[model samples]
Target: MSLSKGRISLIMNRNIQKIFLLGLLVSSTAVFSQIQEERLILNKKREPEVKKIEKKKTSVETIKNYPPEEKSAVPVEYEITNVPAVSDFKTSTIQGEDLSPKFDSELQKNYFRLGYGNYGKFLADGNISGNLQNQMEVGANVHYISTEGLKKEYPWSSKQSSAALGGFLTSYGESGKFNLNAEYNLIDYNYYGIYALQPAADVDLSQKTNQFTVDGYYDFYTNNILNDARVKSSFLGDKFDAKESNVSAMLNLSKHAVQLPANGITMNADLGLGIETLNSEFAILNKNYSNYFNADIAPKVTFFSGNSYVMLGSSFSFLNSKNKNLLTTDEVKSNKAYWFPKAEILYAATEEFKFYAGVDGGLKMNSYASMLQENPYLVSDQVIKPTETKYNIYFGLKGDLNQNLKFDVNAGFGKVKNILLYEANGLFDNNATLNRSAYNFANTFSAVYDNGNVSTITGNLQYYPLANLTLEAELNFASYRLENLEKAYNRPMVKGTLGAKYTMLDKKLHLGFKGFLMSEKPTNSFQIVETPNPNVSNSTIYQNVENRNDSVAGHADFNLSAEYKVHKNFSIFALGNNLMTQKYETFKGYKVLGPQILGGVKISF
Candidate 1:
């Protein structure tokens, strides 16, 4: 369901892939003691009316920011549009369950957390906002987290921090509503992953990243169907000197009635531009950065009858890019166009079961901000390509098996023009004149793309076996056929999540457990071999034995959390993650902080 938090963005291909992620969100309803998590951003297309912008906490300290109970204070849409985006996957230590309390509607709506754990882990997340006048409000939030390296084995340090913070303001007039926000994200991290089987110098394992973003949106609530329009722009970069800027504007229009077979019609379009830079490593084949302009539109018509709905739509995109020739200094320019179907059908054949099927596809633009957030320790000179789904055809059955249990299962197949994968950077010759990137040495990952066909089987289950008890589960299995790569590097064949909660003492004391499970993943390994150099003296020549096939053992990490409400506005929680002490890796070689205990207080005022 969660696919491990860091694994989220990488698998975000539309249609079947989208189904792979959406089922997990729905299964969350089955497992319940009462989940009080307030968060968003990992999936943006689903929230169209709200125009979700993927609020990244700017601070890595939070595995999940804005404790859920507090979300009521600010319109969830307002909260999402202003937050820049979530921090990168930083080999973090706290993938624990949310033990935050679920309060009554009368309680205050602001929430805060302060936690500390093993491996020198520290985190603090809080925010304050107030209504200034009639419909004007101002708010500011703070997020900070720091953790030390895993000291158990030999290789390198995984020390890192998601140190970002910012503020926001919103106002509504007689005509429309608007919100504005700005944030700065500062992250310090390491490239600690090197196979113990093949060790290298510690090298300077540290890396620093600085990024800034100013984002806002204005919504027009008027009489016509042409009602909502929004805008977003951001600048993302890192210590590697990699830089990228993105700007976009979008509009949504919808209307129902005044039609024959089709009762409703809706359409939306987005136009954007990106300027990017990523220096090339000659050995890896120089890939000059591409700056591009793009535009897309999606329009759909809906037909509703009884308890069923059918919709038909299509997606169209246009792109113009200027790229330096690969493996050469010459520049190349190109223009491209893409289109896909967006049709869906739902039929209510019985009160307890429904049949649903769809064929959906779209384009996924990649940027530095998005790529790094997906995997922070990426090679600076890596190429970023936008993935376009040709199509995904799926069908499923979903409904209540009983009042206490519900389930949805689906299977699908699709082809994508550019599906991205995370592979270990190729090791280069030691005698080369090239000044290697910090992410080289096989310690960091690089983004690679290939054309591929994918088939996925996914399911979600939610059940309430007893009063005050909730349990949730989601699972996905996928198989891929690629045109160029050996395997879908770091992509798991099986992924899932499990969660359960129990409340006692009149709901003042809560006990909960949550777990993330990922199957073994294939990877690339490297070793250095020496050969006799006839041109040199007696010294032998060293060569990189690169891109060897390998794999990371599959493992599961479970966390437990307990919380007690001390007063109406205060509470204490004790959370332990990696309880199984699996010592697992969130990425290829970077082992996450595990078997940690964090005790903290929560406040609302």
Candidate 2:
């Protein structure tokens, strides 16, 4: 009975264990199926679904994968992400901004100046300008200056007035740049080169001149070539019944063909061509018409090395001149061609030392208008010609002692053909038969041409230890020889200039002083001496005689000026001329005004 009960209990325990194991397996399978369904739903939402399509009667490559098609299903709730908004916005404010410190940017479009002082002196100057869209500029200016005669008896008063209207245009492009300018000027001048040797009486001498000018320039770059072109035209008219017209054109082209990097050298080939024409008409000089035409071509090669440079060039120039004398009904024509060779070399031994030498020559055209402009005292009776420069050789040394100091010394020898010079006429030859130019006797001069050679030496020095102060000095010495003249008339043997400028109070106050000196120059003069004629008793006759001097005295001039600013746009200025009260002569006998003082005001807008 005990063995039977033990077997039954063991059987019951086995059954219980089997039932528990079956229940646990069933629960685990249900949990795994639920977890798999949730994972499938999550993957469907997060990952892109792909579908494979089967093609009929195609190879393995024919099978293609396509994205899952859109389908409508029950709406499901999902967690939404929260993010911040982004924007690109800013805020700024400007109050006053201290524009005074930035006043340098302000443009001075207009300016005016007026002054008056003793000796009945007067000055008026003004200009107005405007910018057009930053591409062009237009402006107008007017100037007037006058001074009454001193206590002397001779006529020494003068008045000058001028007005100018101009415009400038510039175009900048990828290719290069172009500039255009047009200007018109009306000027009035007085013949004040008198009162030397005490004239018998005052003479009326005043002249009015008008000028119109137009100029254009273009600079272009293409590949390794640079091209430049310039054109200029001018029309000038004077009250002395003189009219002149001038035109000029120039073209320059250069190519940088060869360059050696190993030796640090560059070579450039340049070609230049120029043409000019001048026509002049003068009614006072026996009715004359003069025309001149000039053309030139230049070819050059320039070599630049580390510290040495050499330029080799030659110019072929052609000139044609035509002259007609209406009074004599005579016509004359002349044409010629000239060849000029140019060479220059420079060697920089060191940064502080340089040696340079060059030879150059050119032809200079002369016209009625040009001669009158250079010498206002020139008489209306004049002959126009072109000057030829045969050759000029120069050598110089220039260096800097320091950043604040610089010095230059140079010497040159040159020969010029048909050089123009001015000589006073009718010193004492009042008679028509005795005077060289009887038609021009009253405070007038004539132009004389000569062939001469000149030797010149010059020295210049500059010093600027401070930003506000600058000092400069220049000295020149020249010796001249003519074909058939004893001395070079009106040419100074020694000349020098000393100048100083200082600015203070932030450029509000400016001070300038200049001193000029010229050594004794050769000049011709005549003095009337009365001698009793042997044939005629007690009869006195005046004759012209050239005065011979053992020594000719030099002259010196000093001028000083200052300006004080009361405001940024306004100032008070003063000028003191001939401070030493030296009665010095600049041109033969014309003495400058002595000890003159002028004060004025300046304005800007």
User: Highest TM-score among the candidates is held by which one?
Assistant: 1
Expressed as tens digits, the lDDT of each residue in 67-170 for candidate 1 is 12222221121111111111111122423333332322212235677887776767676656677986786766666666665666644555666666776777
The clash count of every prediction, one per candidate, is 11, 0
**lDDT by residue for model 2 (501-604), tens:** 67677767767666666687675654544456666676654455555332235867566778777887887878766677765554544444556677888787
TM-score, every prediction: 0.78, 0.73
**Model 1: CA > 4 A from native:** 1-112, 172-177, 196-202, 218-223, 257-287, 400-406, 432-437, 464-470
Clashes of 2: 0
Task: Report residue 154 deviation for candidate 2 (angstroms).
Answer: 1.2
The total of clashing pairs for model 1 equals 11
How high is the lDDT of residue 397 in model 2?
Answer: 76
Q: At residue 144, what lDDT does model 2 achieve?
A: 50
Worst 10 residues of 2 by lDDT: 89-98
Top candidate (lDDT): 1
Candidate 1 similarity to native, TM-score: 0.78
RMSD per model, one decimal: 9.1, 35.0
